[model samples]
Target: MLAESRFVDLLAQVLPPLEFKLYHLKTHLKKCRKLVFTSKSDKSVDAYATHFFVLSLDGIDLLGLEVYIYESREYTTMFVSKADTTGHYPSDKPPTQMGKVVQQLLRGLIRYYLPLDKPVRVCLFAKAERQYLFLGSAKNPLKHVLSDAQLVKWWASCLDGLKSEFSSIKKCALQIPGASEAAVKSYLPSNPQLPWTVGDIFWEGAPDDPTIAVKRIPRFPDDPKLRFLEFLVAEKRVKKVSRAQFWIELQSRQEFRLGTTVGIFGLEGTVDKHESLEGNHSITQKEARLLREVTLEGDYSTKSSAEYSSNEFASRVPSYAEIDVKGTLTTPVVKRTVETPQVNVLSAGLVRKKQKTQR
Candidate 1:
């Protein structure tokens, strides 16, 4: 994980989670380079992956002209093409605003990579935003401040290092817009769909599946214990809560799975069929809330916190599954099924402690 100040940490926390199918990042970068170099076909960019777009608001006088607007974790590199230039404008000198904004955008790109995760490649799509056009770098010319070739090279180098360190990228798409906003406005929503953009990254007439439209949520190998917890949640042996009911705290013991139920001081039921303490029963909403509260509150004490920290943690957390019944694709009825790995959480911890002591 990157060591960031509270402000940056808050930014990371507030940003929505980005999910991509495994290898989507590597492939996207290659495809983006291809589309830009080839200028051949329209492409569909996965929504889950990060991306960029350029909006030529030249037609809109107040907006003036700007390039390189948005960027995210999966979508890092963007370049305005001379082919998309308009009215024989001096494409070589990017607007001053372009450099300032793009420099900030570059900061974002560097931030995404600093964590040393995978490098993400995104496609460009143009629509509705009106701007002048020119073809080829030499004909229209990107400002020397951040040339198209420079970005390409930077992205290529970043990709080189990232592929060696992590996974391969996926694909890139470019959606070029027509010369006029009136010509393309009908295709796009009145409001912006994404928080960021980098020169119309998607091509026109791309398929829109909205769901599964982007890359798939990243997956890690499952923990056999988490599979069991999912089963318990599904079987209605436990309940879930929407908000914190009380002050709670959680402590992780090597990510081991445990079945727990709890009772608030004033909950309805007092005893179970076996006559165990009300809080200990594997039944009732109170018990579920108690368990979830413990788990969520417990997150603070652990050395690992962010979802991106480690694949091992990601795999294990789900074992104590607690998700809404309605929103999930799998209903409550889906039985948790998996063979538990022989690895013992206790043994893993002891080994880690021993290694630390030796160090």
Candidate 2:
């Protein structure tokens, strides 16, 4: 994982478990390059498998960007690093806010990390509030003060790189008045969406089947795992307090099979059957909640605390899975019927007498 702190925090805030269906980080299969940002200092970037490009220098993460491919197209989620602390009461390293440093990271990302042949899109909600992006005091002009559209425009310009032919970029301006704003109104200029964008080709557009809209997990170009989970309150009226969202933390050991009810997560009270050898029983609400809670916190230790997990010791769904971690497809477990063996009869013992004469 990338060692950068701010970028990681940004991902957590934007893609909360309840709101989005998350998937495990798998080895990225696409052909790409690892970025090396060399300006004030020389740094080696770690292509952290899955959708992250983490640039580390001397063991400390300098920059982190969440990137992914959808139908051969690359989507750049966010580019972030530790907040700049150049002004009074500054930290050890605070050059991330520097104009030159920010340019190097963005320019290098597209020129190196991303594939050259395919189209790329940057789709993310950039936050307006930042302590470092502004001047700490009136006299300080070293810092580049910016907010909202101004900030985005600066980033877009940095991304354009050289402005040459074969590699030109067209940025869609954000619809905000008076530069940056806390809330975004909307994004315009409608464009055509890809086929898989809707859902699975097989079940997509099926009105009766609501699950058709979900994408699957283990999202290699042609991965076979078709397992996904769904969470519902299952009540007519749900109280705000009780209406909690559920998420499944993807893991290497976990194997999901469609329609196969696995063990419960952490149900409040349950002394009933855990799970039979043949998973044919239906899962109760309590049992589902157990799975929900456990999945939320992938490895929540009983005694020790964790930064991310403890921050929220809890972290989904029925339907085809969609990979929202960055953007891809998700899968759900599917059920298969097994055939029983044919039984042999003894009452037909008369056949045994005839077989002896064949020799």
Candidate 3:
């Protein structure tokens, strides 16, 4: 059919040829013959004739099978078939179905080439999707034999899942401390190789939270006599230091002998310099009790001193006061008086008089 030819062409482009070998059918038949009979006769030959016939027929079929095996510099792969050479003999009809023919070929191959004592690694190539279905051993076989369409669907689903996981990881990496988008992008492969592994999906430090405490032992100890006192003072002043500084200080201070064992004080337990007390000095129980009492008393004294200083500063500032004004509040009132002449009372239009008064 034209459709079949086109499908085969597509397979040729997508799925390259694989490598495989015949099960050496003749030698296995000879071995079987030797085991079955002590003597040979014409009837024995006739009775065993069909087995020989099948062997010869399968040998030709195996040659046709060789066309699918591909070889390259990297590795070899095989394209397994449950059909005949012409791709027509293994019809989906009664008594001559593809499943029966494939089973017969598989049994023959297993019995001859694959010995129970030594396991054979069988790799099958699904042509339609160009994906591999690996079989560890012949004893435990694939549960569901998939058709070409089913294989494509399965491959697509796997790819979708992988993409989703990659996106989630990338998003999470952006939220982690010291992880940059550029760095993640650079570390991730642009085009992943086939037959991927877990290492391909995750990088170093992706699983660890940077905030968690990491316990570390001193690698190289510092000189005992030269830097011991300084190391102790620094350790007392600072709660935490770099791993290198911690190791150096620890080695220097641990050298002093109290009695028989080396006198080791400070820097024993978890050292989180950022969160813990400065110089995280490790002291005996008696010393710790004394230090606690002194700290409490010092805190109380400091609080009292601060309050007294604040009150004294407030008293020193000038206070608000009312002052008396000197000048008069009201202006003096002025009065004016007018006077008329005595003769003007008898005459209607003759006399006039002017007068002025001031207070």
Candidate 4:
């Protein structure tokens, strides 16, 4: 029953600068058919999806986020992926600002999306294990690898507003081997938690938070073995456990599975309109990774237009050259819709005299 069509306006008004990017993201989501309209479902939750948001400045990469959104009614829940592919942006070793980007997004989400005094609920295991700089989320400039406790404490500090007395997010649990309350609190400064609990934290919400609340599930190590790939390579064996396995066992019994399992990564979008719908979920490990280079053969636009992928679009137009963030986004599907920040398709063709040459 979520009117997700208007959800675009929520973020647009919330983040004015990224208006064009948001439009494209929405368009692509619709084109790929990743969005679902779920009225028939008897469960509280329905669809699950993931998105990778990359922030860049004038062709220079800033940061990247891989978020799991669990879609539901009350409010959607988001889980951060702690795998090898995310978090690293600009370079391999990102600064404390790495955490800052995540913090800023959380601030926006909690501020606008949640009811007052309701803590921003995050799904996933905050085991807080130290990890090296991933091409994403590998390491921070502060420490090459942030220990699990350090990571959680760092995240807690994200919600601790400068003017607030205590952190917005208070309770935390340790799913450690020999987790002690004193040991966990020892790692955290200011004792943000009144009584820091132990073991994994769980909330009812979506795995991929699409602005709506739904049941949440683990996101990282999404690659499957015989299990759900819960444990990492240099980490514990899980002793061989998967969240999907748990759901299977539960559904096998006369119990609820909460949210239905969906694939993380690009598994959802990989399906083409022409492909057979039969047994879509069966193929998990191998999918066509290489996209066929777009051929302009027999294309009406390509044949008729001279402006197709032309630098004239960028060089001739001031608005296209500069990303001018204009106008505020109004509620109820925008009272005044803002202009998009245009990007010229053929900028790489132009050669500049300022290009670095022999010294």
Per-candidate clash tally: 55, 30, 12, 29
Q: What is the lDDT of residue 95 in candidate 3?
A: 15
When sorted by TM-score, best at the front, the candidate numbers are 4, 2, 3, 1
lDDT of 4 by residue, 149-229 (tens): 455555445434311322333334432323344654454447452344433343223323232111223332221221222
How many clashes show up in model 2? 30
Candidate 3 error regions (>4 Å): 1-95, 129-147, 150-359
- Give the worst 10-residue stretch by lDDT in candidate 4: 285-294
Per-model TM against the reference? 0.18, 0.27, 0.18, 0.39
Model 4 regions lying over 4 Å from their true place? 1-45, 49-51, 73-75, 82-96, 112-120, 126-143, 147-149, 159-174, 191-195, 203-359
lDDT of candidate 3 over 185-276, digit per residue (tens): 33223453222222111122443323211121111112132144345446573323433344344433423212111211110011111111
lDDT of model 1 at position 261: 13
Q: Quick one: best TM-score, which candidate?
A: 4
Best by lDDT: 4
Worst 10 residues of 1 by lDDT: 344-353
Q: For model 1, what is the error of residue 180's alpha carbon versus the real structure, in angstroms, after optimal superposition?
A: 19
Candidate 3 residue 300 Cα shift, in angstroms, is 99
lDDT of 1 by residue, 178-253 (tens): 1133322322223422222222222222334232201211111122222333443485532331111101111122
For model 3, give the 10-residue run with minimal summed lDDT: 342-351
